[model samples]
Target: MARVKRMERVVALTKQLVDHPYQLFSFTYFCKKFEVAKSTLSEDVLAVRAGLEAYDLGRVETLAGAAGGVRFIPCHSEKANEEFLTELALQLAEPERILSGGMIYMTDLLFKPQLVMRLGEIIAQRLRHLEPEYIMTVETRGIPLAVFVARAFNIPVVMARRVGQITEGSTVSINYVSGSSKQIQTMALPKRALPSSARVLVIDDFMKAGGTARGMAELAEEVGAKVVGKAFFIATQEPEKKMIDDYTALFVLKDIDTENRKIDISPL
Candidate 1:
């Protein structure tokens, strides 16, 4: 193989750090692989960090000492986050996106890999400082978002099911009131899913009254895990009394005019 140029090496190193979010890499590995001096490698790392920050791509951090190394923390500036959400809200506000029962047709948006990846990055950045041990979400719609966030944190994804499954052994089930319907519902999780006293971050695709989010939190309690934070892709403004009060959301469903087939949404 031909020798790689300095610029090429810097680009390659940046990709590796960005792809392996939150994972540390020692300078020794890069120095040996690129056959460069420690001082040269350090300069390359600084250049990569500067580029990421200037372009609002993310952040690169370094540590010094025996256990110290460099790691990439996924994040975008607050202004950029707001701009992205504003554009997304416009697409979501189309009259055709409205459905009966005050529901917005977001299935197409939710499944888009590009959009989901960005959403995960923003949510991960907001909750990353908490140092959550695992990412949890209810089964089905929220699974994709949870998986993306788990990748960002280099952690595992824990799921809760509305109905218990025979394959999952020794399950713990709990009943919570659905905030919208005011009816009791059951949610279950496997006993071995999480360790005792784990710090969990909960992510959901959408929130109406936050009953499902609350139920997942209760289920986490059953396994002795503490909920560090909760986040949502979208949330409705109706049903004034939400089961869960403290949470973060990307979009707020301000109003839905069923008669006129119109919708209003805003970024938070």
Candidate 2:
């Protein structure tokens, strides 16, 4: 194959594996299909990973244990995060996606663990390089995928709650604007959730106007934790472009016409 053609195949294959994480795809299979030796295939994999990093897509991970394999992690690039987020902004505008309560209906997308996990991989991969001490998210919905990302890097998971409980003990709370309502909402964390100077990566399922994100960031600050980065599965369009300036997203949904049963999703 020509240089350009071979490079394209490398990129395509990387995306395939990323689109399906936890499932192993042996290098041997690609070696045979591409009619290339293991060494050359390895080099191609590196190239693909580098290309992704160059574009803020993610990174490649090669497992070495008995059940080892390659995987793609969609980590945000420092350079292209804004452009990537703009793509997500576009996807949130679809007319059909708005719910009766005005809350975006994303239950279907959030329920798909495979896709969510992969999306988590992208968020995890980007923060992994930053070497954050832990991944943080709000209680309930954000926990599932936040836990996944924490597990991905073998790091601990810290969850903030809408209300404090005796079970969690001593806590800190911060008032942040709710992304959906543009009203202040309280988010709390256990005093021991993290230590001073520890690095934190904030994550959540969806971002409408970034109130929740700002809240979490504020909480991190109160605890003396360093808010290193933030990311989400889907970031909706921001009419005012409120506080979530330094964040990344897997994709954006725009123009959701629920009455039309139409949805549009694309990389951000």
Candidate 3:
């Protein structure tokens, strides 16, 4: 194979690292792939790291040791995060989003691939310090966001179901009240979905009374897993106190005036 140029190597290296964030790649692997000396590859990696940081794309981390390697950690600058959240808040605040029961319609934005991907990056950046081994969420709406966060961390997403599936075999179940409806609900997870003593990050698209988030935490505990962190894309401001005290929410929902068809939401 012909020798690859420095510029070509840097671009290729950036793509691989960015595409597989948090996945470690050994120097030996890259050296063989590029057919270049370790010293040359080091310079190429430096250039790639610099470019990524300059653009606030993410970060490239290098670990030293026989078992250590390089990996990418998805992140964004504070300014960038502020700008994106502000724009998203504006969109979410539109009057048309108000539903009949004072609920704000957000299913569209939650499912948008491009939008949720960025939200995932921001959430992952905030919770990365926890070093969670798995991303957990309840089934349905929150799955996409959780999946994206798992992708950023290069980890698997474990989802709990509203009702236990026969296929899941033995399951752990819990009954919790709905913060909004004040109705009792049941959520369950397969015993095999999460291993005992693993660190878990609970993610959800929306939180009201925090009952669901609290229930997820309980589910994690039932399996002997530790709840390292909890995150929500949007959380309501009322009730002031949430069932779970520790959580990160990108946006706060102030109120919704169904009578006037208005929404009061803003980024935090």
Candidate 4:
């Protein structure tokens, strides 16, 4: 039989486990599929996992012992998060993305499907231990991450829209300043939506002064739903500097200067 190129087969196999990373599978099965030894298969998977980390393309997490086997979870290492966020900073450097105000065209990056998918995975990894029953976000920008987290948990995401959509049922409204600009923004949530007992992870794309987070926290409280924690894709300001605390971010865009075209991206 013609032999399969080791790199080609191993990477292919690694990508297959994206859907169910925590499931158990055997080395002998892989050996038969790849026509390689137990030792060679082990080495090949390790190499591929390492390459994945280098590229910031998720992770190759393994399980061991009597009830254990190998699986690949879509997760971000600290380096991976920083690498992806750096790429995003370059995209944000485009002149067209800059708005009339000082705001960079960050909304585009926040809305991109592929970027959102990865960002969602990074958020999911952070909250996986929390085991949130639902994902929550304030309307507009936060919707993307909330959707992705909802998908990861196979649950529905509830949005606190700034203006109540006619489609939303049984609503309650609250007023607070937006974190980015300190402009007062009113956020609304459907009263009947999230059950009071639900444990929710609040998600969004960015946190500047954290006024939006505060608004969401208030909305969550009004519903009697517990805000177990919060997560954001980027934080323009440090959490310590903000009024709110206990949140995780995949990256922070430390600086952005369009004229000199310099930007800083870091993982947290």
Q: Give per-model TM-scores.
A: 0.94, 0.63, 0.97, 0.68
Candidate that scores best on TM-score: 3
**RMSD of each predicted structure:** 1.6, 9.3, 1.1, 5.9
* True-structure lDDT of candidate 2: 0.74
What order do candidates take by lDDT, descending? 3, 1, 4, 2
lDDT against the true structure, each candidate? 0.90, 0.74, 0.91, 0.75
Alpha carbon lDDT at 128, candidate 1: 76
Please give, for residues 196-235, the per-residue lDDT of candidate 4 as tens digits.
9799888987787788888998898888888888888777
Worst 10 residues of 2 by lDDT: 84-93
Clash totals in order: 0, 21, 0, 1
Worst 10 contiguous positions by lDDT, candidate 3: 96-105
lDDT tens readout by residue for model 2, 1-268? 6444776777777767666543456788777777788898888888877877776666678877667667765556554555644544454545555777545666665666775665566576565667777889997777778877876665788999998878988999988778677777788999988998999999888787888888998899999999988888877664447677788877665545566766666666
TM-score for candidate 3, please give it.
0.97
Which residue pairs clash within candidate 1? none
Clashing residue pairs in candidate 3, if any? none
Model 3 score (lDDT): 0.91
TM-score of 2: 0.63
Worst 10 residues of 1 by lDDT: 236-245
Candidate 4: residue pairs that collide: 97-105
- lDDT-wise, the better of 1 and 4 is 1
Runs in model 2 deviating more than 4 A are 1-98
